[model samples]
Target: MKQFTSIAALTGLISLANAHGFVTSPTARMPGDAMASACGQQVEVNQQSDNYGNIQGELQVASGQSDYSASECDIWLCKGYKFADNKDNVYSYTAGQTVDFTVDIRAPHTGVANVSVVETSSNSVIGSPLISWSVYASTATGVTANETDFSVTMPDDLGSKCSTAGDCVLQWYWYAESIDQTYESCVDFTLGGSGSSSGSGSGSSSSSSSSSSSSTAKAETTPAAVETTSAAVETTAAAAETTTAAPVETTPAAPVQYATTTFATQARQSAEPSVEVQTASAVETTGSSVVSTKPIPTDGTAQEKLNFVESILKYLAN
Candidate 1:
């Protein structure tokens, strides 16, 4: 009975072991370690516990190796360990986990003639993953062999998942060509806590604001001038009518006959001296020089009568 009880206990232990499948904790195992390692690269891993209650690790290459180094193995081991421990769902790793990531570079619709990149987040860029970035000529298959990768330290606030919190996104922008003009393409990497995705920074122009203000100023300044011009036109029209009326009243009614008559009367008065001589001669010849002499001749001509009377007065005084 004792033996049977011991066997039962052993059986229970076996069942429990079977239920919790055995997992090989990631360690520096020779060939496998080498295979898992990456040189001058960036890697990511998603780790989850399987139905057999064993931790399973799957490696993903976030960036590719441009050069080989000892640090790459270290990165691979660290990534594997993290997966085994199930510490985080998203992991960012540098160096190790030998895998190649292909990045296809495209010119903007405007296009780019050349491009350069810099790390806004990492400082160990020299001889690191940040320096290993590859450049490539764009093609139908992908970017040409000019592309490379480099190492960089991940920011503390990026790549973590969250329900309400947010993350810092690492951005990479490259200039390329389209139709011989330069254009830009950008990619973003998120870090430290996640929710819904968000974007980065932007730039703006004050020219639009200036244009709006100028339009408003023009509208404000023009209306008064237009009104003044209209008022001036009205005033000029009224003045022109008054001027036209005055000229009509002053200019049209005098006669040519009256002017000629006045001229003839003045001429006769000027000839009075000659008329006196003629009257004196007549008086001498007729001896009938009645001192008044019929007041000289007045045949219904007032101008001639006045002249004859003046001549008689002159003769009598002499």
Candidate 2:
């Protein structure tokens, strides 16, 4: 009986090791009723059991389930987590805001990883990945600190594409080729000040608040000028209203986020378009591992290596 207990414990450890990683902070979407309806009950159950389980593991369960709908499941995207189920957990962010991410990696698997804003309707990346690592969670080097804790700045040029909660997601994608496992976690978000109407409204509110504050201060300074100031304030308010009423037209090109590690999209070539990374002196390829042209010191801790790589990538981007 003691021998049998030992075997059971070993089996449980192996089961735990089979699954790998998931985003822990910013409240990533989890499998739910909506996901069950789309990806089938078995697939949903699989994820519910181990949220860190990869896409390949979910697919293995999906293959035998008759309820799994390929189109509806979208297994390759966000590990098939549905926006409908995650509606209550959407994040509201302004353009150029910085979002910090924390991932819990149960086990290390050498992979390529990136975080990007994805358009849910079409399942395409909105410009480029906010952060990327070509050699991520390497077995040789083990998992690095930055690999689990990182921050990304939201792009200002998303326009109105991500203005709605369900329209887009900040997705973290990791593909481990050695194990043929893909793990994804999505953070539903809406980019504020992107829509013309909403932007104009916010501008108007800010202007009105500033005008009110200024008028109050002026009134406090000179009681005699109260009447004259009120008249001037009315005129200013009228002008501000007129200015805000007119439609604001803006046509700005989307900007790309540069990282030391090239964004790997090759594993997703069939689903996404090729992304190009160019430096002042050299050009890097997408969907594959990127190596720095300069010699990097190999004599440092994992954190130092990450810092050095970032410095090199910044130099190259500039």
Candidate 3:
């Protein structure tokens, strides 16, 4: 029993030496009964002794324990910290709110790190990371001011995804790739309010675009309607001109033909009356006496007719 106790103490010391970092501010989740039931009592006790230890060390302790259930523990996420144990420590935040973070680095190991909003149930990142560092806490370069002290702004887009206390967490993830060690600490948070101003801005843009499109449609339709009406008006005017031209052409033709026939008949009648008067007075002309005579029929040329009338006029004068 004494030998076993000695070995255990030495193993604990080794694990502590290997562990590098943990979140110091904002009261990160700690091991409790809920964690022990899922991760095995030994693994829970191991973390209770040194909560700053890495996930690799916890897995080492869990390997020999029959009670550890990997599926239930989900140690890869937040080092299997249970929300039930940290219920009282949950944070309430509004969208676009900024939160300050402080991490204590007991030992330096060059690594990559990020802080993100994570959904607790599915272990999925809610969105892009709030902040990240490609190189962090290098042994040679040492930890920097930005690495240990920083702030992350809550996302504007998470409307109700994190309204409940246990639904989500602000997770700090650090992986020392060279050493193959990973450490995680989670801060429980519940978002308040409907959403952020950015969401409202997007909606306003959509409405403006819709209004502009509608105006454009109306503007296009008006020109087409005017063009159609103009075309119809031009067609009607052309048809009216064509209809009026037909009556003018037909009416003039009939009047010209009738006038020509009437003028010829009057000329013939006048010539006959003069011929009759001259013939009737031809035998009685010497002694101032008058005699009636019938007009003779003649189909003479135009000059002959003129000569015949002139001869009669001279005889009547004598």
Candidate 4:
């Protein structure tokens, strides 16, 4: 039972470390996904990503050997791990067409991906790979999820290489920012259609005319002509910082309590309608000493004086 528990714990840890992800679009002979149509053999994934390992920095700039090291081919992702059948033109793409590069994410991470095309003849990535055209380059800012999609317009210039080389390779290198890890994928394919031809590869004369006009306009407006003087900039900055601040901390004086006997005085005055009663400021006590300093009525009958005393007392209590 103890041995069984240890084995189970080890298995759980392996499962966590083996969390994987890869490009699921442009169909690059992924594991378990049938590749008999494009590849030579059946590709299987023992680990989520097979022997493909982690790498650091931008793929185009990063220097090191991955699990799929280049003893076989740097352009070919997964190196010797992939099947022997993957060395052929899998699909063809038209130049200048907007393509969506999609990736399946199980173990989502943060990073950017660079998708580019290169000549398969060289199969070399040192210095600069034979990526005749850099299709798209961008950072993965908000990418964390089930699928990451990058819409990139393919470059029209194949630079006379594809004219004779026949086919090219598309490679997507995904590098994780938080860790020293990188995901690499490649698809063997050919370039054809509208933009692939050398004749049409160069843009139309109208585009070139527009580009020339833009350059001339830029040349006309030199930096010295539009520069702001340092003294004027300093003055503006000084004016912005010249702020008059209101007091932040203030101490309001505590309120004073003045002795008020308006209600008692009013009650005393009201009692005078029936009997002559003194005001609150000048009052005299009568009958019981317990009701000290009360405004009692003078020259009043016993019942009238008693009523006046009760009325004043009620107001005074309130």
Candidate 5:
């Protein structure tokens, strides 16, 4: 356990060094996080914070940022995540009020940023984030930081829950587009008034900060052979059934067509030869299994015969 604790401490320090910047203004003040909190120290000008150090950016909720847990996150990079912390420790503000979260831009890497709200009640992402585009850096204002701002609105949907929990968490995530990295920071605060009629009418808004995360969330694949072939068999069978019966005597007969299946294709189909399907037993055993389908003939007795074959195939498929 001692070994694990040391390793975890080392890892947190490493992440802080790499991620590169944090909430400079409206300084993120977490009780367990900052040592100054022990002495009840309010922030003073010219005094540097004891929060995070430079670290990498480009974190996706699915990957980089720490998950919203029922447990408190005492570790450094967990976005000041805490649960059931003392209410006296939190800062207060109005719910549904738009607030600008200032970020200290340390690195020159071009990136996009977002500020969001996570409702403590559900531990879910509540609404639209205040996002900015290819936000570049600027000159420092007081020997403090090269400042850029992310305007965040405490969602009105939070309602009286602000007073209920007496605290809500604000998350700031910056994804470095060029660099495949992410940086995040969080703040805890309370609302002044009820959030009942404040946010956009929509219940919940999705996080659109990282397109990479969006693409990862949506994944599609080619359908399995069984799914494709089974549906095909049913469709071919149905199409065949609609054919009008044609007399063999008047039919211009054509040899039946067959497609040679490779070992892989055969393995995928896992079906028997067409001859097996001729029997009623085989038809009953396989529900509309595909045996090669013939091309639909354009005209004449051949067309009628083609239709007749279709009907037979459809019956076997069923």
Candidate 6:
């Protein structure tokens, strides 16, 4: 009877292992890249394995420039397990399994910057899960900041694993800071099922490896039309001055001279040129300057008058 009980116990253990299948593996190691703009950068989770399969996740970034003297970063894992929760201190999964993931990082300043991720799965209390990473600077700015998001698939063979589902956990570490600053901010991920699991071993699994982002904020400055109007007015005034007409000068003609003669004789000899020439001396000299003045049109406002004057001057100058 005792031998029969032992066989039954062994059978139960084997059945439980088969029901749990294999724990999903965490993503692979990703190198850090630089952020060169105030807008920040995005880093993708790139670990995967065929044995455990792929998982989706998302990342969110916010600036504390006004609240914090230095920049700080926080990463939230909406799904999966964390390294700290696992006994091995590193993500654990069945051998030969693969998991796919992605992350995004943003920069707060212009020029090149570096970012990195670390993985740890051993000696739970002594070391962090980070093993390898990539680093480089971003090359853009403002809305164009050197931010980018990428993804990769990695094999779960990077670390060891446990025998049951509750024994393992997955964790992530992320950082984004200026190369010039000594302080760097980091974020981690924790793992848990998306509330669909029942203890019976028969349940549904959802993807927790994708990310979604909200729209950017609108600009706060005024429109361009106001500036354009001011520029146009100034240009018109300048053109008017350049096109104004120059003043004209006039000279009075010299008085005419005539031979000495009487008015009565001149009248009687109007038909005779010689007599008319002699009679001209009797006429008195009259001086006059022909100063002609035309009324300036005043029907329009000052601006209209200015515009009109400007047009006339421009025509004359041309």
Question: Which numbered prediction scores highest in TM-score against the true structure?
Answer: 3
- lDDT of residue 114 for candidate 3: 97
lDDT of 1 by residue, 191-210 (tens): 22222111111101111212
- lDDT of each candidate versus the true structure: 0.27, 0.68, 0.69, 0.40, 0.42, 0.26
Task: State each model's C-alpha RMSD to the native.
Answer: 41.2, 30.1, 38.9, 24.8, 22.2, 33.5
TM-score for each candidate, following the candidate numbering: 0.17, 0.57, 0.59, 0.38, 0.39, 0.21
- From the highest TM-score down, the ranking of the candidates is 3, 2, 5, 4, 6, 1
lDDT of 5 by residue, 18-61 (tens): 54556754444433424223212221000122234322211211
Higher-lDDT candidate among 4 and 5? 5
Report the number of the highest-lDDT candidate: 3
lDDT of 3 by residue, 102-134 (tens): 899888888999999999899999889999999
Worst 10 residues of 3 by lDDT: 200-209
In candidate 3, stretches whose alpha carbon ends up further than 4 angstroms from where it belongs are 1-11, 194-318
Q: What is the lDDT of residue 234 in candidate 3?
A: 34
Taking all chains together, the TM-score of candidate 1 against the true structure is 0.17
Over 258-303, each residue of candidate 2 has an lDDT whose tens digit, in order, gives 2221222211112344333333133222312333444555887889
Alpha-carbon deviation at 226 in model 2, angstroms: 46
Model 6's alpha-carbon lDDT is 0.26
lDDT of 4 by residue, 184-250 (tens): 6765444444432222111211112223222221121211123333443232444334222321334
Q: What does the lDDT read for residue 257 in candidate 2?
A: 33
